[model samples]
Target: MRTTLSRRSLIAAGASLLAAPALAQSGYPNRQIRIIVAFAPGGATDILGRIVADHLSKAWNTQVIVDNKTGAGGNLGSDLVAKAPPDGYTLLLGTVGSAVTNQFLYKNMPFDSATAFTNVALVGEVANVLAVHPSVPAKTVQEYVALAKSKPGQINYGSPAIGGTGHLAMEYLQSLTGMKVEHIVYRGSSLVLQDLLAGNIPSTMDNLPAYIPHINTGKLRALGVSSAKRWFAMPDVPTIAEQGVPGYDAAPWWYVSGPAGLPPDITKKLSDEIVKGVSSPEVDKRIKDAGCAP
Candidate 1:
């Protein structure tokens, strides 16, 4: 996912943080820090939130908590942060929808996703894979498209939310492949994945974190990843662009942020810590194993 933090800026931020003076003479983060995750547990954003919280906890020598605040197409939790004090103790690990595309979808948006918070760091992104239950006979994306064409609108797929990247990715697939499939929206990835695993839904598209283990266990078959290139964790699976749809890429990115009035130094401190943590080799491997990019 693209962001204001370019590669060079990220590298410089990390180096600057390490040598910078200890956060505030009063000792910032004297108490626990809370990272608000706008979805239920087990989604990509939740998993990444936990990872970041763990790192920040260790780095600042304070307890960092992941508070799951799910509701209103992700507006509830996000609004909580938007209204929270800008002392930097309360952070938000908002996804692409909450931080970027949500403003265009919801009629009564609580806050301007673009301006309500201070964009701190790029927390990394994960590919969304088009997956089907094992019962589906189609193995590749082309085969799946052919099958869908045969059945047309009868075939249904699950998405995390109505205007989420997963839903839009599948919609984009429909336009590219010329297949008309039904879409069912869910509040979160866990439930959608649960139904898919139970064979209640024939197919679905979700972030790589929630679906990779099932795919690895052969419970779900990955038709194609939505990234431009095959993800590192699933190197054997071809991307949709490679399969047939050229230039098809819609991976959802995550970013860390605080309320709109957060101090610049506080934002930089958080961003620096996150960049350093994400750049570490051990954390990189862990992120890959979680089916994400760091």
Candidate 2:
């Protein structure tokens, strides 16, 4: 399903946080702030969540922690923040699934993704790479597609979650190329990478960061990237669109958000701090090093 959330809405949606009874601006964050990461600890979400949490902690002179609440394609953790009191203390390092896409993929969402939380700040977008174990026969996108078509549903590929961009990008690839493959869904990219390295899984479409080191070490072969253009970190790897599949761009982004109904002052403060932290030269380089553009 296509997303109704446009680029403009995404930018605006990123400027809010939790809401309800507004806390006094001066005394708002007297306690520790919890930023829930709705995925496993080694994925892009967890990495960026910790960066933002550290920044917030120093900025506010208080403790900020990233709580990993994994399961049900991130709905479990996102729901925790949605139901949290709109005091701004509880926030979410949200992904596309928790923010928008899951609303279409799941039949009965626990919380209204549209109304549950406020968008505090957009972190950055990361490319999803289609990489295979070195043992796989295919070495390029065309080869992979041809191989999948030959084997039909026999080929198994792993992704972080069902509704996640990694999975959707693969689905989009199948729709465009008419190739049938089985999806082996995992809790996060870290786990998928572990299995892929162990030769337990043949291939994966996941965020570029965690796969970069292995791709460089020849543990995995990057067939194509799911971005419009070449990713800076892996410039040698061509985009999916460049390799016979035109218009195949499916980059996922990260953001900070809190329960809906956050006070305007608190929202602005959090948004400003998040934007500042993400834009800092030091943090900027870190994001780039992690294979994402800050």
Candidate 3:
């Protein structure tokens, strides 16, 4: 099973909200097209981006590359795509932050997400897992919360980006439980995972896919998942709501988009190809193996 929430369900939930305005362009992607992944390589976003790129490359007989542009909580890369020509040659594998949440999280946004780009396709959703290094004593979500409450701001947790879903999920958890922990934000999930594995950081609430192997290998201990219910890939792990906090859900979605002014014809082509690419047998298994719903 891919997820409790299916791909169609996620599309239904997010597509309308991300619909973009119409404009001009033609011939679609005749040359090499670039898909900008605004996070470091090896994270869920980057992995999914490459999956899309590979599929598109074969399907369209064009070279599709994934560029990792990391900075400013994904705004740097997002802004780059926003400012690029709306010819469908340059695209973005956008996360929740780059698409929606960063506007509210940041004081000054370089581009207006409202009109910057056209939403090509809603990729899928992934739950952020709240995991800690073995050094931490906490074994469950309640224990982790109690530890944080006792230490207050002393406990530090690493997140992929400032306004990204991982960061926001942690913020949401703190708000619901009144637990205080210092935030150690990184440019991407790989860097955060690096620090966490080396025991440089004690805990993290980040995308579950990147941490799954370590969690299974005993390098990390998963306290709880940030989704509303148990994740299909990690059903043994409980949700935060089940552990202690009720009604806690912070799953994040991914999508493909290009700059605004893309002609309706080009936009439809891109969206159709993306949806088809992700649904292919190979890509679908890859997404599910990455612990995301496809």
Top model by TM-score, which number?
2
Lowest summed lDDT over 10 consecutive residues: which window, candidate 3?
Answer: 1-10
A best-first ranking of the candidates according to their lDDT comes to 2, 3, 1
**Backbone clashes, candidate 3:** 0
lDDT of 1 at 92: 91
Report the poorest 10 consecutive residues by lDDT, candidate 2. Answer: 1-10
lDDT of 3 by residue, 92-137 (tens): 9988787778888889899999799977787878999999999999
- The residue-level lDDT of candidate 1 at 172 comes to 85
Task: Name the runs in model 1 displaced over 4 angstroms.
Answer: 1-26
TM-score winner between 1 and 2, please give it: 2
**Model 1 Cα lDDT, one tens digit per residue, 1-294:** 344442436634644554436455346778889999988888998999999999999888899999999887678889999999999889898777786667878889999976888767777788999999989999999999999999989999998778777888898899888999999988899999999999999999888888888898898999999998889989999999988799899988887888987775677677778888988987777777788887
lDDT pick, better of 2 and 3: 2
- Listed in order, each prediction's TM-score against the native is 0.92, 0.93, 0.92
Residue 232 alpha-carbon offset, candidate 2, angstroms: 1.0
- Cα error of candidate 1 at position 117, Å: 0.4
